[model samples]
Target: MSLDTSTRGFGWRAVQFLTVLVYVFMFAPILVVIVLSFNASQFGGFPMTGFSLHWYAKLLENESVLRAFQTSLWVAIVTSIVCTALGILAAVALVRYEFPGKEWVNTILIAPALVPETVLGVGLLLLMRFAHQPRTMWLLVLGHIMLALPYVVLVVQARLIGVKRVYEEAAMSLGANRLQTFREITLPLIMPAIVASLLLVFTISFDNVTASMFWRPSGVETMPTEILSMLKISISPEINALGTLMIVVTVGLPLLGGGLARYLARSAR
Candidate 1:
């Protein structure tokens, strides 16, 4: 091999090695948590120490965990639905219309995601206090919706941008009203994006902790907050099991959504 060819080969090999190292570094902790969740030992630590589903079974028996899980599920569902509905309307308006301060409106809509969670949480708390609003599950739901809305709007907006205005015009030319054109032609084109947004928003709300801590009622706890309380005392295998389930959720929903989006995209074509 020429000197230049040898140099290029070594460079490519170095890049590949670094890429693998980066992925391992990122995922190793998650893999360890998953493995340890099945550990039969009383303490969470090194060595296999045998394997069992005892931790998972214990999760079922823990009333606090179950209640917290239900609370988290309810918040996620409400947040996702609200965000998806509002996101679609906001995205369509931003993409399809030319109004004053449109850019500013877009910026304001997505600002929640850009801001630090601590800042957002504190701001919302102060706002609630100023308005004489009590902290409650509804407040938690609202916080999650704010955090998740940007993602939904961005996803739906991208899909809408890819769609041609001519399609809507064509439908209108055929005597279809604006609403009919949107329902029949535009909605189908963006259904995949909407579905993906729903799942994405659901995952975000499910995993939220910082904002949840600020907005949740005094006695109530969501799963993440409940897990935080557990950590205050000790690190138990049950926590690992809970973390594993969360991993399955936060990771799985996006993967499932991506697959479904791909299927829908192909079907639309």
Candidate 2:
């Protein structure tokens, strides 16, 4: 018994140590970038030459950066809205109804996520060319929607699975129609998941680089593509500053969305 207890203790300690190391490895580079973003040095690299917000100030003054940010924001907003709406419908159909080829439908919907971004990007570019379609903001929007829809579907579907259909039945039994029942009962229950999906899709669309590279209209730039351009030119502190801001937003929004989802889910229960 003592031998078993010692072995278990050692195993637990090893797991904890490994977990800590994993976190450090994941975050250490991000931490370095954050520090460098605020560095007073003109260069991006480190030797800790005091702290400053010069790069951030430069970002504020740069029209191209602002324009790219606006473009990214617009795309993210549109992608989230469309993805959430379509995702909700798809999740409802998948989870709440019986249909032919149901499994196939689900697999098809999520296949884009399973495919490599490079392949998807190239495929999209080729398709556009084959279709004789000009690369446009609309093209970028569509690509982002395709990439983000699966996540929204998965999140809402998971929530829908946990939701008791009996509530909808009861609402319908109370003389509510199917649409009415969904609006009054089903929609509320799944709202947290919808919100979470919206935020998550926004993050995905905003941070998208690979597909955006292929789909973006000529002479246009989103923030991610803009950063890539800047990197091609030079590794300025401005890039680090922009990166740090993106990290805050990309990391913070999901956390906020998750917490909100949990709180809302608990309240619904």
Candidate 3:
């Protein structure tokens, strides 16, 4: 009995320590940024002189940063919608039906997941140029979609498989057509995954630097692109403020969205 109790105690300690370590690993950088954002030093760093919101106020007035933020928002939003929809369709087709080269087709759909962003970005840029395409918002949108689609498809596909088609089958047996059955039953059931996938992809596109860097217009910028440009100059408190804002936003979105989704899901049931 003493041996068993000791072993259990050791296991609990191991789990607790692992949890603490994982959280520290994840949140240490964010904690530093949050603390440093308030530092009065013109440059973000330790041994703070004073705490002030000066940098955030300046950030509000920075036209270039604002423009880049706007550009990133629109691109991420459009990319999420387009890629999520395309992903859902492809995932549904692959999961719910069988056709020629099904495995091959699925593999191709998942190609971007493993492909290095730099290589994909360069290849896409070259492909667009060869097609005589202008560098535009649409091209950026397409690039983001390509980057995001694999993830969206994978998330939705996993949910689809887990949802137990028996429920959809029952809906069909009740005289619902294929389209109606899918619309009413399958879609609603997996809506959580769809929403999660959209948010995740949007965040990915919003935060992506290397790929978007290549595709973004020379003068135009996204938040990540702007951050890259700023890095070329030097670190500033304004950058820290921006980083703090993003950290808050990134943390808020999942919590808010996940709660809302859960509420709806429960209400639906």
TM-score of each prediction:
0.95, 0.94, 0.92
Candidate 1: tens digits of C-alpha lDDT, residues 1-269: 45665557777889999999999999999999999999999997777799899999999999999999999999999999999999999999999999999989999999998999999999999999999988988989988999998999999999999999999999999999989999999999999999999998888988899888888999999998999999998999999999998899788878988999899989987
Q: Give all candidates' CA lDDT scores.
A: 0.92, 0.93, 0.89
| Residue-wise C-alpha lDDT for candidate 2, range 180-201, written one tens digit per residue | 9999899989989888989989
**Sorted by lDDT, highest first, which candidate order results?**
2, 1, 3
Candidate 3 is scored at a TM of 0.92
Poorly placed runs, candidate 1 (over 4 Å): 1-7
**Could you arrange the candidates by TM-score from highest to lowest?**
1, 2, 3
Top TM-score model: 1
Clashing residue pairs, candidate 3? Answer: none
